[model samples]
Target: MPSKFGFIYHEDFLKYNFGKGHPLNSIRIQMHKELLELNSFFNNPNIKLISTKPCSDEDLLTVHTRDYIEFIRKLSETGVGSVDDKDTPAFKNMFEIAKTAVGGTITAVDEVMNGSILHAWNPGGGFHHAKQDSGGGFCIFNDIAIAIKRLIKKYNLQRILYLDIDAHHGNGVQEIFYDDSRVFKISLHESGETLYPHSGFEDETGIGDGEGYNINIPLPIGTFDEAYIHIIYQILPLIAEFYNPQFIVLAAGADAHFLDPLSHLQLTSTTYIRIAELVHGLSHKYCGGKCVLLGAGGYSLNATPRIWSLIVSKIAEVELKDEIPVEWRSKYNEYFNENNAPIRVVDDNPPKIDPERYKKISKYVDEITNRVKENIFMLYGFFKLIK
Candidate 1:
């Protein structure tokens, strides 16, 4: 019997590390693996562990230019240069690791389309900020875009939905597919006014035939779980129902959590689980449960691993205790020299947002949501009942 869930991972994934102090550390990936291992998730008969091979040059060219690819290759060989202005640096073998990440995502898509699994997750993928000519935000290759292109060409997929919940905008993915009507991109993130890459405004609906196919909901800073959930529940289902995509790709970033160092959203582990549940439910309803989840930008070491663990558990339909495994906690404590590692999977208490502040944020989110609905939803005939 085939497994219901497939997880793509390789030890080589740890080679994508940016250095000791960089926010995009690969240690978080290892920690997530440890958490799942503590729970014996790999031993489950319904879950399959998959390995990844580096994608070929042809695969890279699907979304990147040959000149840019050569630049990255030379930088990787030298092992000492910044790939972009600053955020992404060229470490030893950077090109190979980034290529492997792309391959992992493509492999996940193949598994889903071939009926090997109903769903898949790649913890080392989701380099969504990289563009055709350059890398940014610690991303060397836009794996999500390359995988989408491969899916369209290999399987002749007509309608594919790319949903991003990263705290920062998925500008690269949106840009790559901006003029393609067959792929719809929806991103919910902190307003660009306060985040990096500084794009994904509500007005960036699309271009030419792709107009209205691109949807962005820019939430205000300090937005809490309740408000976030409200916006998600209101917008996602309607879009999924209207688009009726053949497949769903989710960029699940943990940076929006209150404990994260990078962004100003107040989401908790519970919020992560809820978001995953919503995406999982939507995939089942509209795409026959053919969804691929990718890890994106989450900086806080303690919070990121736990948040991702919740997402994996949700997809695998496994229940883990609230308490973290004692042995794992001790090991991480020894490794990080932090005695305060969380012993429980879920946050003990929800991060509190002032009622008045939450109201203000909620109103702002409503305005953006309404603007998106009026601008894009109407074009798709989804506005009839929304208004």
Candidate 2:
């Protein structure tokens, strides 16, 4: 039997750090790995730790233009100025680090597509904001798009499902595959009006051949677990049944969590676990368990790791201890000094929604769900699934 899960990691992933004050710190990735270690998650016989190297230019050129690649190369050499809009800084050897991050994602795809693993997670991957001609939104390379392009080129796979639960819209990936029907992109995120990369609106479905292939369910602010999970279940199962995707790519952004500093979705570990379970089942049902999970956005050092760990636990079929390890907490406190370090592996007291607020959110989600059903479901001839 194949390994159940492949976790792609590289030490240089830590080198992807932007700066001291930047919210996108690499230490959280380290914390996630160490927390899994402390919890004995890696000791399972079916779990394999995979290493990666920098992706070649050929792989990057699959999605990025030559000029943009050269621009990044020059900036990395000089180590001066920002990669894009000052959100991502240009550092010495930054190109190499970004390439390695992309490489890790490719490695995860290789492991899964080769049948060496049923599932994989690249915590360093999911730089979904990077476009072909420029990098921004804290992304230097479009790793997600490159990986999808590789699947199309190398594996000749069609009907690839790209599900992004990131707080922000997967703008780059959506744009790159916007006119292609081979890839089906669905993004559920905080409303672009309220967040960065302000896109992913309901009307921004897709264009040309990709019309109705791309789906965006932008949620209202203060969306909690019940409303979030309800929208997920209502949409994804129907999509799986209709699209029958051959591969699944998930950009799992934990920033939707209530504690996260960036986005305002107000989710908790409850929603993450349900998402993991749903995606895992969908992959097995339609794609023979071929799935890749990529770390996207999560600002809170405390909640992000815990949320990721919770997803991994579900995918790897391992039961995690409710209480975070005492020793791991000590290590976390020692290194990060995060006052909000999680004491439990899952949220104990998730943010409670006020009754009036929940009413508005529920109504809004219901409207969004109906709009998506009418817009995209019709293209798939999914009239019955609409209700």
Q: Each model's TM-score, in the order given?
A: 0.96, 0.96
How close to the true structure is residue 74 of candidate 2, measured as C-alpha lDDT? 96
Model 2: runs farther than 4 Å from truth?
Answer: 1-3, 334-340, 382-387
- Per-residue lDDT tens digits for candidate 1, residues 1-387, read 333999999888888888877878788899998899889888988999999899999999999999999999999997898998677888888889899999999999999999989999999999999999889898999999999998899999999999899999999999999998889999989989998889999889899978889988887888888778877888888878888989999999999999888898899887789888998888888898999999998988788889999998987787776789888787778445348888789887667788889789988877776776666557766546666
lDDT for 49 in candidate 2 is 94
The stretch of ten residues in a row with the least summed lDDT in candidate 2 is 334-343
lDDT of each: 0.88, 0.90
The list of candidate 1 runs beyond 4 A from truth reads: 1-3, 334-338, 382-387
The digit string of per-residue lDDT tens for model 2 on 335-363 reads 44545556888888888789999999999
